[model samples]
Target: MFLNNLFSKIFRNQNRIEYTTGKAVPLEEIYLSELEKYPIWIYALEEEDVEGQDEFWVKPITNSTNVEAELSTPYILLKIKENNCPVSALLDIENMKLDDLQYWDYKYGNWEELNKLDMPSPIHLISIPSILGKPAVEFSVDIKPKNQTTAIARTLMGPDECKDMYKTLPPNICPVCHTPLKREINPNFIVSNKRSCLRYTYDSFCIVTEDFKNFCTLNHYPNLEFKEFPKSPGNYYFTPLNIFPLDPIRQKIKFEECCSSCGGFKGAYGSSPGFKSKNFTLPSNDFIYRSDIEFGSEEKKSPLIMVGLETEIKMKKFGLKGIYFDDIYE
Candidate 1:
């Protein structure tokens, strides 16, 4: 059956050769809103974009960081440092309705409605990842970084095509991103024996392990789907089916550019989907929820996936490697 499906697969129109590589550049510096005394004002480098945002709020018990290495930069560089303030912060606007968070207009010298395009980074982290007071929400899982043993299979159409190449991981809509760039995906990503699990990039990418797939199936966590790779039986192109809408403004979400043909956002989310509130209802154990916002740029466009507490505990108890959770998203 696998061979029949593979051979019958129709190759889509090939455009340019694949060149999207998901990589993280060094962050200019660490940023957090908790230490600031004044309103958050990012985008200082550009005067036209000079504006004050409602600081992203976090009722934290404490704060900390383990980002000893590099981090994903704001696609356009937002970690601006002022003389009085080391790092300017955005408004603490997460989960709150649009009418809630306002913008500070420098010209009028009065707070006004914020446009979605002008929203700043939502949550800043320098403390414990897990919210101590929350009922059962935990911080991010520890997905292993991409290393020597990892073999990244992409859907980005290359000059030389193979069975592994695809237009989307599920052989359907590329659910993770909203890029204007033409993209072809390899849904059947293969993994190596060296690592128990894999990933060097952010969790936005829908890559996963065979064990994870089995665990989901056995546990009846239905929102996730998987496509196994024949070349490497242990690997799979994993994707989540459930979705939740994202607030483009307050979360630093928007399209830097857009593709004319598709009218899609030109790339994936510049920053991860971060919010400091847990005001929404969690999905049941049978499913997980993905933000309507997708992350990654040309190389990859995917959503930030969030699972409920039940799913989190099950995965932890099952001993899934390279998987972690964060308490940031709404």
Candidate 2:
């Protein structure tokens, strides 16, 4: 009943954190590093006795399905323990077939592995999705400890012992810190002008505010590219490999005044503004000066380009990094 009581108190509860625009600094301002890795989510369950006593009789319910196929994704069933004996932990029956039995004794590290066990005792039914993206139906089961010795022997000593235990990967991570990203769905509006804060969620867990920002990618040079200057007048640098002068190493330690065609020093020995230019102009004039410039026009019959650009024009004006595309049209 404690599980039922705790579940009723916390489920569907929402927490909020407020951040102001402009008042808050960019994530890059705090951390200069980029987000190079993906993040993951974690879930755990509790094992205990029926009356919230130390004696455990609850057996973890393990189930699987193979109605359409020979095997299905596995789901763990949790139960309380009492006197080193096992009590029932059953799930509701449905269109799917359930099999396989594995007992995990937190009291002991080794799990009692069974190939195929009998159907579980049904209690309450829940429709949860399988890891393989299939529909899953589960039944809750009560437990009865098999022994009187270790059932009272316990390790997880707090109310936090009960929880679902599983893990999965989320797509993004904090550009600064590499912690798993969480979601805040339709959270309270912290900033008066904004309707929602940027957040990510998995199941009932979330990464909010500071945690939310950590999951976003820091794009320093998302649109960066290098072009070639003619080695000799009339000769063109076409392929990526053919353009050796454009290489990172060769591009460094440069002489400014050289023939645009021959790329040799004959005129001035000083660096020219035109020697190398950054934030190059794309072929499309309409997309000029946009940090998040789109590549082709819809009427022009070319591939459409989309990239993450700053929402504010001031950021774009200050040369903020963002996504861009080039025209592939003749």
Candidate 3:
């Protein structure tokens, strides 16, 4: 974060060029009539994969998510051409809310649709680091972790392991994207390995902490069932008995190729930042829950793992690992 500033080369009646001078520059130093700089995170800016590189690319990071930037600094400003004019918006972390993003695609630019108003631009989303507040009431004031890291670990039920769950895609699958027009989980998931103790998984597969499970039990976290997986005590797996439909959008998530099934998608893409969707809906803040909407890929998919803010605060005392709560955009 304490690095050298960045500067952009200015060209008149031509395109604006940006470059770094081995130092970070103030947001004001790179002012332009045609462009505006926004704050974003430095965590993985250089490594992030924005699907439509041929059509659009990320704007220069004039304002990285250093300690001095916005409270939610983990973000990136994406630049795309709309009506032959440069336009951009912030792709925030965690909360995947693309409030003002436009004309997003997973493949090459679709110039014909640039002028279409209210067309939601697909972009990356992540949760920013946040400070926990006082709990409404403690879930278990007595329970605490010896060390956060050792207590929790991430888990993924990859392709081979999850294949039998859906041996074949439903017949009504989208012919273009190959997404099942109507699909559902196998419902029978056995938690095989239980030795992990506390698992905290994220991304398309929303695995949560088993420690938080214990903590939430006292406070009445519903639909949470921890059984023998890997044999010792607790693990993460999708259980239909515990799922409910809370993910807001009714449309299918896509990476590219405008299919009748998906909103906009082409190939394997990262999770959409649905925080900015006009029809965004969130699970109630009353309980730590799971979304009926499944995330991840056809090879391997998982549920939209979710936790309520209030419940998150209550879990704080347990000193849980690998868990953070981003405000759900309603």
Candidate 4:
């Protein structure tokens, strides 16, 4: 009878939805309001807390560098600093309704009435070490609804692709030096251990064939000399030539090289238009980091801000990476 009771208790616990308060809510027929009662718990990295410790909270996964949480229905993954570090509890959106959630709407393309809301004022500016070891500025924005307490944290500047200061330029002109760029010709070469009979240099890597040589001679520049392959094999192997522009400005060339077969370089690299200028204007200070709260009261809060110190560390990725606040859509 004791053994039977132990098995039954285990089964019951497995089926229960545990909250941070040591309370269990049935997994089925659970309402949004029930989950909101628990404070959004923030666990230290690798800290093992009891299930349901906070119904809507975040914690680091076991033996992993990522912090994960299910904010209502949306699953969030954050890349933060070192392991075992304390996580700050920044926001709580329990009383928020689905229609009033802007974070969810923006991500899922259900954007409606987004611009009608007032932008949240910046509460704090935290400088944290990004995955790239550069100091990344995080802005904490206060949420509204006078009665509900919620906030959001995001990077001061959004993704690099979304930045407004960077611009692209047209082709032919060297992206680095703004000078006329020319193609480089070679007799033979090996790239990635593969042999090529001929090569043409531009921003894009390309190889030319014998047919391409004939086509270029007849139709294109007929005066240009084309090298002929010897009928008898020789012990000659070609060294890769540095045809790339030496000028720092010329290195950013956006023009792609073309071959005779397809009239363009195959498997081309760095084909995207290079930046027009090398200098980048920093983000404006007037910019506000918006929050997810859409239809809440416009009540204002005192600017009680907090900022974290920057730490330098090695990372696995190249660009800046961090966790941003997101809302549950479902």
Candidate 5:
């Protein structure tokens, strides 16, 4: 049995492509587009197979909660067919489910015997798309050695690993051509507004323009008053909108800005730089700039004022047309 196992190891090694040979291409040069054309295989191991293997079970401290307690030992392997061979092509299992009874039987019932076989046997194959979708290119194998267990350490692959592998690939290389892709932006897309302001505070007297009046009416402001503007024939004064108090002892101030037409939250600015602005489209077809001042106080009741300004420009849409990856020699 020992002699037979030794010969089997030698045979497997001989079949594997040697790194010294020019035919052995770097895994990074292989793109998902090209890989999708060919079938791949995922090797699932039983939980018992990974027991006593720290490398397989150890979780990184930063991602302990995110990592799955059970490692999906689905190691991906590409299936290559030999030319003019009488043997039948490997069966594609891309659509096969891991939980299927037939798959379970095939994996456990015959895997042991196949592993013990002295001669090369057929390998079950699947596709990357079936397992990972188009984002399969963003994943790679992460292997570490601990007590001789080479099982994958994490179930999910991170973008950093994928980026590191394809470092030689151009930053903007087209997935197919291996050349830089051109990026064009269309400056006409309307921004989708999705945030709401519950309350707001301003330090100075607020001007109620016609736009402001329309905004208040659309937003169901019950207390707002509209007065004809003396300076303009068609403009009106918007008043009584909720405003934050300029109290020196107030710890925080908040406000909401609704769209004049849709009553949606247009955008908002706060004293704190950490405030997140909600999605909003420009009130007018053209770009506009708005500014406001916020008032508050320090712990000792020292008066504080913060000026905030925002420029809402038309949304810009980007398109990727011409790009390519560096030439890959197999």
Candidate 6:
């Protein structure tokens, strides 16, 4: 059966690869209002390791990197540093909405009738990928309400509330340089799952298994296993769940390649377009660590599940690696 299916699949168009799951919602069904509230910004601090010049690092974070690739949606760059200040003119706009949303909350200070904006709005992480594309450590943000029917907000009424809408994180320091954490920081909303099972409720690990099973069953692959990887909080990206976990290790091997900045949990290794390496290596040490620790524990509070790796032997009759974001749409 697998061989028959594989041969028939050869003729399928790779343009849009269909998933085991059904199609996602229609474009019109989602709007800016339906997306997460705050935009998710990606801050990247980088040094080119050029010859001769003393290595100068951007303290905290700075806008010096270049954009590589973007997923989820796209937005524009608005160079304004003003956070809480009211956006008075249309030119004050920075980013635009790319996907649809269910609802949104907006707040604007003063100029009550003219400056106010609100509603169940769609949002976007506007300057994220572009900022990531720079040479300096840039602060990328996505401001929702990218698309609105009116400028005067109907949701989140009142002065203090309006001020809250523009609130920033790590307050008072330039989010990039510790000058001030401005209201301009990316805004986001929380998505909660109430399922009680460790595998279903607490962790998104099942996603890995489902993807693996689909590929193995359809492609007749072999020796496939899921491995855990690190998660990047700022990017809101987690490693695939449903992989094996290494037993805690004592007297673990240490390395000299540590970040000059924050040590321990805060240290850095290497980074790719979407992920940053953890300071320490996984005990499994195997290029691929495989495990399946289900979620469900009441102890978990973080929204992101630990990342994991997926591996299959070269001899495996079937199976594939690296699920593409575009695959979801296909």
TM-score of each: 0.42, 0.15, 0.34, 0.15, 0.16, 0.18
For model 1, what is the error of residue 135's alpha carbon versus the real structure, in angstroms, after optimal superposition? 42
Clash counts for all predictions: 38, 49, 31, 9, 19, 65
Quality of model 3 by C-alpha lDDT: 0.33
TM-score of 3: 0.34
| Full-model lDDT for every candidate | 0.35, 0.22, 0.33, 0.23, 0.22, 0.22
lDDT of 1 by residue, 1-330 (tens): 000021111121212122122211111111233222211112112122212111111121112221111111111101211111122222112221111222222332222222221324342212122122222122111222222122111111001011224333433343434342332334344443322343322223455666777887787766666666676676666566776555466557657566555566656553443552234454443346666665656444666666655665566567554443443344
| 1-330 per-residue lDDT for model 2 (tens digits) | 001122322222221112111122111111111110100000111212332212111111122222112111212232222222222111212324222223432332222322112234432333332323444334344333333221111110002111211134222423232222322122221211111121111222211122112222232323312222222221111111111011122223233343344333322221111111233333321211211111111111111121222222222343323111121111
Cα lDDT of model 5 by residue, 64-89, tens digit = 11112122322222322221111111
Ranking by TM-score: 1, 3, 6, 5, 4, 2
Task: Superpose all Cα atoms of candidate 4 onto the true structure and report the RMSD in Å to 1 decimal.
Answer: 24.9
* Candidate 4: tens digits of C-alpha lDDT, residues 196-245: 22222222223334443443334332133333324312212112221111
Residue-level error in angstroms, candidate 3, position 177: 9.2
Give the per-residue lDDT of model 3 (tens digit) for 81-151: 22233322332323433333322222322111222333344322221222122111111011122222221
Candidate 5 weakest lDDT stretch, 10 residues: 154-163
Candidate 6 per-residue C-alpha lDDT over 249-274 given as tens digits, one digit per residue, 9 for 90 to 100: 22131223322332212112211112
Regions of candidate 2 where Cα sits further than 4 Å from its true position:
1-97, 112-136, 142-330
Supply the global lDDT for candidate 2: 0.22
TM-score head-to-head 1 vs 3, winner: 1
| Model 4 lowest lDDT segment of ten | 300-309
TM-score winner, 1 or 5: 1
Score candidate 6 by lDDT.
0.22
